[model samples]
Target: MIYKALGGDGAAATVVTAAGDARPGPAVELHDPLELLVPDTEDDYRLTVDPDTGHLGFTSTTEAPYAILKADPYLGARRKQTIPDPAFVVAHHGGPAILERTASVLGCDHRQLRHSWDSLRSQGNMTSVSVLDVLARTLDDPDGPRPGEEGLMLAIGPGVTVEAARLRRT
Candidate 1:
């Protein structure tokens, strides 16, 4: 799994991170948030990025810059992760609103989350056994957003959009 986060609350930020073992094993009740995930296989889905059209590119092992960019205004460059999950990218920087607003930033829809998961398990692709976690988080000022802070997190990795977190702001 992978995780990323930008320090919010305007305090002197501290950095933290960790990863889960990927060797074939039983699904973990992973200490990780379960939301911040990246695909462990391929062809389960597809990745579309057109730089000429301003689409951002992201890898399963790398932080999704578009996700970082989305929360940068309210938070900043933030990310993290843990072991792998079959479907969904769990994230928790600050709650659900972030997930809700993901379409605005990532230029995709919530369905993209499922699409990502399905993409990872298609034929000719590696088989996905079970799913343990799927969530995301972020920060949004109550008085800041026109609609509201985009809660939860949404990222595009090598597969479909990985939905991470169930965000909130303090």
Candidate 2:
């Protein structure tokens, strides 16, 4: 049950996601696997992503492991800054295939993007990571977009997955 950090607004259940299927996907905020997953303790934390370098990290606003997360996200936007939906990325065919296809579409590193995707799951305990949600929301008109254009791509895997949006260098 991965959650969207809505414009730094608390997780909103309604905002659309670029993510696709979740095995036995649970509704947002629904906790059916509580019996198997450990509960999280309350703590303030911040994580920011640097698309330029593929750096994913976190900082805590409150305590130990947390403070590290809270440490300045010097090189990139702060955790609360919302990366927009993809105005350029395209949806690839399927599986890992999407990685290279999307990178080609957005001009990002395919392998680095793949690592970023895997990092989401390995680093944080996100239930399911969203790799292409931001792009879809920004670029495609879910209802349908211009001809020859596909919405942003989304892929979710076991570990926190790479969830990113495409942006044109302005």
Best by TM-score: 1
Residue-by-residue lDDT tens digits, candidate 1, 112-158: 44433433333111112111122211111123212222333334333
Per-residue error for 46 in candidate 2, Å, reads: 35
Q: Give the runs in model 1 whose Cα sits over 4 Å from its true position.
A: 1-41, 44-142, 145-150
lDDT of 2 by residue, 1-170 (tens): 02233223222133434445423322221111111111131233334566898755443332322221222231024212432233233222223443444454344454324433453334332222233332233333334334333223333221212232322221
Clashing residue pairs in all predictions, respectively, total 49, 18
RMSD of 1: 17.6
